[model samples]
Target: MTDTAHALGASRTLWELIDRRATLTPDRPVLIQDDRRLTFGELRDGCERVAAGLYGMGVRPGTVVAWQLPTRIETVLLTGALARIGAVQSPVIPFYRDREVGFAVRESKAEFLAVPGEWRGFDHTAMAGRLGARGVFEAYDTLPADDPSVLPPPPAEGTSVRWIYWTSGTTSDPKGVLHTDRSLIAGGSCLAHALRLTPEDVGSIAFPFAHIGGADYLVMLLLYGFPAVLFEKFALPDALETYRKHGVTTAGGSTAFYSMFLAEQRRRPGEPVVPTLRLLAGGGAAKPPELYHAVVREMGVQLTHGYGMTEVPMITMGSPDDTAENLATTEGRPPEGMEIRIVDGEVRLRGEAVCQGYLDPDQTAAVFDTDGFLITGDLGHLTPSGHLVLTGRLKDVIIRKGENISAKEIEDLLHEHPGVGDVAVIGLPDADRGERVCAVIEQPPAAPPLTLAAVTAYLRGTGLATHKLPEQLERVEALPRNETLRKVLKYKLRERFGAGAGADGG
Candidate 1:
């Protein structure tokens, strides 16, 4: 327990916050998915009935409930209902393969698994069975209309587990991130503050609800009594239509999503800008400088970048008032009451929203210090204005002829190439230079396979030192990414390309 959690105290748990908001704005629209609309009162009613039903099903306080629900109102209700009953909610991304799904179920010691029957061409029951969890409940079947009045009381703060988020582990193996009741509240409140979300803003999110962005966005909108619009999946045309149809004023997604939306905008000219869409927000990695500028010019909306991991939630974010340069280059200032510092090229943070630690003790010990700072593996320097600019991950640094090079810097440079869709840079162990830069790229169908000479020449044209240019370029159909669409496991690419393999295959 930390004193900061006490200072930023709330009277009740997050469920109570939702209940209080419902009381204040009972008739206000709360959730909209496709054609279905739910008011605060109705949302509360559904949550109550679901919570009561879960209680009847032998779910008790402190039980871990794993849900593979899609981006639907049922998932929203289940989250709130679990919070009400003091049960820990672990959301399994719908795209998880057998190994990933099984690991999550075993890692969380989930007693009950809730999943949709069929979603996005995947069968949840079949996937859940492989995970060794018993008694899988279908999403829609769980909502019984009997309206059982008994519901377990909210779990005690600090003692109750809110949710366990598993990182993509670009730098290391996956670790279960544990958050407390205090952390979730502080995180959501900070996000609502930094993003300038209001009761009038219709919060729209296209990312999978399993990720931190979608989960926190849903909670923040409900906590602030704002209308939330949930998208089943990412479709630029459908997203634009929904934004216009729902009068959605605020949206959250990733840098890639913003880029895709901008590309769609280029295809359709003179399209009416969703006048109500005032804020376009992205988090995780910073957007490319060129992509950010083009989005602002093409979409007529401000792009604000937030910075946070699964552990700390939304710790920093670019505000609507931030300068274009700030929004483009940095991760913005740390959220209110969050402290960040740079030491030995690593970013460290301490705040109420920071989690207790990873589930494994070894992982916890590796990431935290005795002084209570979370050592983020990212390499960055904090500006004098209190903003944090991410340079690259420390592990991703490549050494060429005794000069340290950032892979992310090279990736950003490669992104400017019209033919390149996505790319990842990795360090191949070299006896001479210690490590050499190798790039794996996904190129456009119209573009011929990239040659090593072409990549080096491109780097040289940009004034990169000759030694820093990649010695090899490999083309691949698709880069391996996690459920959140973040590229990790570059070792797979290394196995294929680091051995001087040709671009003909993988």
Candidate 2:
């Protein structure tokens, strides 16, 4: 496939494109909230005013602005404002508690912070107070009740940093990913092409605008002159309602979230059917084939899988016309300007999409091999047709008696079990062998207890390889996941199980 000509322009920067949209489509709906909406003109004015405010506060081209607001109009303005002023916006998911937020603020060395006054049962003021007291951030509340009007600031452009994001370190510490004006525009353009977004398309965003997925989708919508319905928080039902009410043509999310939402929606049927919805797109984690089938066959929408990270934003995305097998199994092919290769079962990506490197030079050097290919720790293989099929994490793969095991494969199979609610499989050190597969399970309140014997029996019945079957299984109240509902703290299980935990020990 050839790169789409519409995906890029010769000289237009991201800020310039946004300015053109605001100027050309001033009266058109740019953002829609429940009972309120902002036309392109209003959004532009808001961004300008916010940029002016930041400038008064001494925000400059290279400054890092950490934004921790819930989904709202402010998130839009803050993001756009930062882009216009050449300031780097580091979006932190609002759901992150103290430790996570503290880590982001400290690591990013944010000069300024923006958050809500109160949102979704969280006290924003207190959170802001804590961040402010930490001595690195200057926090501001985004409630419309206070400081409603502000001045429009002068444009800041050319040679300015636009955004900074953090990669989700499923197997290691989070690494900082930076984007300049050119790169961000490139990313948005790639996303627009991958999703085939158009001027008439409308998107409702449920994910927090702080992450790359959220920001990429938001910017793509704007760049294409499409309207975006912003959510202050994730409410599955509310999101569905928005889909129906707005006749949302597209939406973006993670595999886990889209699975949960699609599962819930399939259980009940009615009007507000959202027949207009063409694509339900997501990435970062592998989605079960059943979930993808349900979203397509049952719900009558395309469940497109994409592949990207904070380091390389939206590099590949499946098309609506993709085969069901492709949609369910692979992460599609590379987007414009991206080059991908698989060496020794590990995926390597390079191009404008690649990150500038981690905040720490040593860490950055460690992650990227020579020749500039990002040594994505993800274990994947290129299909005969060039599609990328993710197997599991390189560090997360379990080596049991010389047999390599994919934790994701086992976890996916476990999710099909009737009694299992959620699970995380990890590799723990073993004296007899290099490592052993251990599963930490979270069952529903009414579900019966799970045992190692039962798990092995289930795996056997499912026809999984004996080597891939978990040697140890433990039922826990819950597994530690991130705010995105992604399993992150699997190390805790290995810690508790101890290095030498055996099959019988569990």
Candidate 3:
């Protein structure tokens, strides 16, 4: 399977990968959604027809098309059509509003924009009109279609930047991440190799399809010739029925997703969440070592977490054959083509999967070093055996009285407590201490209320250092998370509590 996937991965463009896969197993199913099953051959035909329609609508080879759509077969088909047209495509998360959508389209100089007419009662067409976006059109259940002969030739080269993904706008407006078809194919190839998936295996895309991971997952389907269930709007238990219905073999999106499944499993002890589920794997957020163990023990499945970002979707991924200890403690090893170098505790990466650069050339210049390695602001070290263990982000280091404290270290310890459903440790501004450790927690149902003193006592009992104790704690109803991956927006916590916003403790 690896050899075949590698060969298919060599295809110059995404369209080429699709064409190759279609030729190999034209009758095999590739995408399944509520009542709709699309085979590989049908996918090719649909993409070409959609491409013809888009071409008739003035979409040329280099035309910039920005789309904001949900996870649906039509969405994937539209993306394929754009690829077939050799258009520079920029996808926006469906949840993004006026500011983000407007910024992305304007910044990308989008020649056309696609949106669902009125999905989930939002009236996206109206929103696009309000933004004064150009070439606005609806592409939901019914897409514009035409004969394939009307379209031009598909893109031949894969190195040109044809895909623009957005960074999580946790801080401000997201920078448009530039990716070539080859880069995406490389990332997906790393994933397909590491997971050891076969044609018999089924996957699921529970997250937003507009995310960069969407392409990575799509490339895997193309390479391995497998089908994945698409969730337009995924919710627990409700979506579990589809997982079971499709007999999904591999499932996971991020750490938040794993926690959701674990919480659901706890509802029915000794029962599998998804009976067919064998492995849970994902990246995009920090996975606590405790979460890894819980999923393994209670759910009766192997959990393989990886390290990836928008810049490089699959830098390192945990293989199913890795030792339990490595799976729990490390982020797994980089593949043959990936090069990892740690300088001053920062993880630097140089690999085919890495994106070309950001839309802002200045930002790109700042991120890459003289050696061309993308300077990941993440702080970590590689083990002797080549396993990468991330400590925390460079911005996550909270210094108090000349001593540096890792927020991830404290959060990991706090996650072990039964009373804590979720927690985020932030460094709040403190005049006396320069920066003070503050822990914000979300309480679970039926759990005892946690106080700052009780939390500090628990940390001490865990053999945690005295100075690393959180000086302040805030119990919130829920942690603020980005819509895409549910990654905790720590900056929001700092903004909320740093100004002495009535938090508990010193």
Candidate 2 residue runs with Cα over 4 Å from true position: 1-12, 131-161, 168-173, 269-272, 397-506
TM-scores for the candidates:
0.78, 0.74, 0.81
User: What lDDT does candidate 1 reach at residue 336?
Assistant: 66
TM-score (C-alpha, index-matched) for candidate 3: 0.81
lDDT of 1 at 194: 72
lDDT of 3 by residue, 1-506 (tens): 47778899899999999999999999999999998999999999999999999999999988999999999999999999999999999998886667668888999999899999898867889989988999999998888899999876788899999999876322335578999999999999888889988999899998889888899899999999999999998888889999999999999887767877888999999988899999898886666678889999999988998988888989999999999999988999998899999999999999999999999999899889999999988899999999999987755566453234567778888999999999998877664454678999999987888989999999878656566788988999999999999999988998888787354768
Q: Which candidate comes out best when scored by TM-score?
A: 3
Where is model 3 poorest over a 10-residue stretch in terms of lDDT? 166-175
By TM-score, the candidates rank as: 3, 1, 2
As a TM-score, model 1 comes out at: 0.78
Model 3 ranges with Cα > 4 A deviation: 169-171, 395-506
Which has the better TM-score: candidate 1, or candidate 2? 1
lDDT of 2 at 35: 72
User: Which scores greater on TM-score, model 2 or model 3?
Assistant: 3
